[model samples]
Target: MLAPFTPGATAFGLAHVLAGALVLVSLMMLYQDRLPALVNVLALHAALLGIAVGWQAWLQRAPELYITAAIAIGFKAVAIPLALHRIIERLDIHREVETVGGISLTMLAGIGLVALSLLVMLRTAAQADALAREDLALALSVILIGMLMMVTRRNAVSQIAGFMMLENGLILAAAGAEGMPLVVEISVAFSILIAFIVIGVFLFRIRERFDTVDSAALDAFRGELQ
Candidate 1:
């Protein structure tokens, strides 16, 4: 069995900083209108996750976590973002993201979600390790914020980014938990890869049929067919 986690002050501080940074990046994604800029932010978010996982590996002495970190940085942070950039350029989709609600309202909702997550997680995980409890709370906030982004954005690409962000939150939680098998991490990574491929193809097909990547347009077309 794994030893009890009793991280020193510096380790806890670094962990808190990394977790907080992920939440901040998620918030940043909320108001981003430009697709390219949003992609860049997503890349940053993934890179931070990689770093955070690496830190967790060091703290937990789980060498397998290093592979998780490498996959996160190499694929999610670098390759995926580069692929998105190419997709945007190939599709010539340079328009600002179409949001369903006012930015102020969406941001307020995001803040509320964060507060709720913190309250709920802290209360429920009270007996857990301090660092794990905090990470779980912050990860929940990121997940909620990502869902908010998905609902508030009309553009398909933005929704895809939000989906990826939600997955990142899951990764954060997994990394925080002790004794999480490497196989579980590998499975999640492969699932994300498969999802990305399917979504990429779906995007191209949508563009081909509708001449736009706006999900709202697809909904309108469905309504017309009805």
Candidate 2:
């Protein structure tokens, strides 16, 4: 009778579904060109991630993790999107996102990344914790897809979206680990700092100098020297 249920089982299942949906959402975010929709979807993904972490905290009875969930809900899901939207309005660079790899190919690469994650996780985890093993595989898939989006997209804002998805994966990894004290706090602070620094330097500068924040233009500038 005691062997039927396991700790973190329900929570793990919930987190897996939520994380999987977010991964698909991130894929959609990658190919999106409409600024408002992109922002909305990213915010939604952040909210889902917060919910997953909060559910995990509740199931594990860990009050410390609740704080991380709250930060995810407040800062990432709400504040960051609002700030980014304001920046987009101020910059007035509302245009369709451009991509180097195109949508179909990017999707193919996403599939490949997912398959690779499954293969790697399954092949290497003989003695690992079950929840951790699943989380690692899912998180790595999301991270790889995010990275692929970053490389394929030519719009600065879309690239930022990709970066946020990568951060989401990192949060999942942190939550899945057994003894990662201060990880959530450090990650939140670091993310905010990175975003602030990049936004301050690049967002306005791109608008001012080139009248757009297209990555291709930036790359073209670099290519001109060679």
Top-TM-score structure, candidate number: 1
CA lDDT of each candidate? 0.83, 0.75
Q: Write the per-residue lDDT of candidate 2 for residues 1-226, one digit (tens) a residue.
A: 4667765566678877877786788777766667778888989988987887787677667778888888878888898888777767766766655656677888888989989998998678746887778778888888898898778765566667777888888887787776668866876685777468446735455433342467777778677645
Mind giving the per-residue lDDT tens digits that candidate 1 earns over 1-226?
9666665977988988999999999999887888899999999999999999899989988888888888779888888788777777767777755656788889899999999999999999999999899999999999999899888886666777888898888888989987688734663666487466636645664332243467778778778644
For model 2, give the 10-residue run with minimal summed lDDT: 203-212
Models 1 onward score TM values of: 0.85, 0.83
RMSD of each: 5.3, 4.0
The window of 10 residues in a row where model 1 has the poorest summed lDDT is 204-213
Error of 1 at 203 (Å): 6.6
Best candidate, lDDT-wise?
1
Candidate 2 runs further than 4 Å off: 1-8, 201-203, 207-226
